[model samples]
Target: MTPTQRHRVLALTPYARLLSVWQTLGIHTDHRCVRGPDTGMAMVRGRMGGSGNAFNLGEMTVTRASVVLEDGSLGHGWVAGRNKPQAELIALIDACARQQAWARRIDSELVEPLAEALEEERQQASQAAAATRVDFFTMVRGE
Candidate 1:
């Protein structure tokens, strides 16, 4: 996956799911936190339609962290909400993803499953919304 797609998967993966993958992999690499799993506010923006003038929707809680592996690979993680551990795990995974040895395993074991789960969630939500959708039509009256 591209960097943006990878980050999305890492960020959206649940804390429990990430933890499970971490434990299953038994990752014991030498690494250190460069920044923090610090919580802060991020401004959310929106458009009038899909491509109109932008406006600030609101501020949301965000946590970000970074890690540096022994081989000097840097990894960063940013996620919505205040889950410190999740942010840290994401950073760790990011760093690991940089390493050639760990890249494929990370993709298969972590990224793929998470992506599938997220897609399933989107599909279910779409189906639910579609079920409630209403169609309107106009009838013409001849004079």
Candidate 2:
């Protein structure tokens, strides 16, 4: 089947746990937020006595994430800004929830690469922190 067909099924799979694995390994994305133009506005009149004007100026912020599989299938998820991880996790899950042959390819290729990258980052961070190790001492007053 086509990559698109496979992606559709993978998109429905339960892959939220993958995101946690990624986070544990330190491979993560920055927060992404989207705000649409306001659709409602208030009218204001000139203090000197002029006609009032009305405009649209209402807006809300929406957070989302996108993941592309090895076979080129893309998945996206929208969530609240406070739940950025959830959004990314959902996106990845959807990308793997498909039943197409391409889904297996994507899991092996794309997901594997991502997991490796995350693990590498975690190791680097650990090494860096270790390099800054310090020891402290306290005096004995009873002596």
Candidate 3:
């Protein structure tokens, strides 16, 4: 897969699902973290009304990690929470997924299932939101 595809897969997956998948695989890996899973606030910038001037929205908590697998593949993981263990696991998975031996299994077993689950969750949320939407219209008055 292309680097963009790999990134998209990782970004879309929830940390909980990632953990579950890793546990299910039961793969023994020896790796070390090159960077911390430290939590910090990241400044969020946004444009007003979707196309207006950019401004700082606020800061959000984020955790990032970097891990190098035994095969020397370096993987980086960043998530939107202060979950250090989750970040570490994600980094490990990222490294493992890049290996030729583990690539196929990781993609098929972890990425695919997680992607499907995420999509289903999004669909359900969209449906629920749509059900609550209200449309207002002007009623014509006969004179």
Judged by lDDT, which candidate is best?
Answer: 1
| Local lDDT at 118 for model 3 | 81
lDDT of each: 0.88, 0.50, 0.83
- lDDT, model 1, position 5: 77
lDDT of 2 by residue, 63-111 (tens): 4667776566566655433355555565655555453643565556545
Tens-digit lDDT track for model 3 on 1-143? 65456656676676676777778988889999999978898999999999999999999998989999877889888878798987788888888888889888888887778778888999999999999999999999997
Query: What's the TM-score of each model vs. the native?
Result: 0.87, 0.35, 0.85
Q: Considering lDDT, which of the candidate structures 1 and 3 is the better prediction for this target?
A: 1
Please list all clashing residue pairs in model 1, or write none if there are none. none
Candidate 1 runs further than 4 Å off: 135-143
Model 2 Cα shift for residue 21 (angstroms)? 19
- Which residues of candidate 3, in runs, are more than 4 Å off? 9-12, 135-143
**Native-to-model Cα distance after best TM-score fit, residue 7 in candidate 1, in Å:** 1.1
**How many collisions between residues are there in candidate 3?**
0
Say which candidate scores most in TM-score: 1
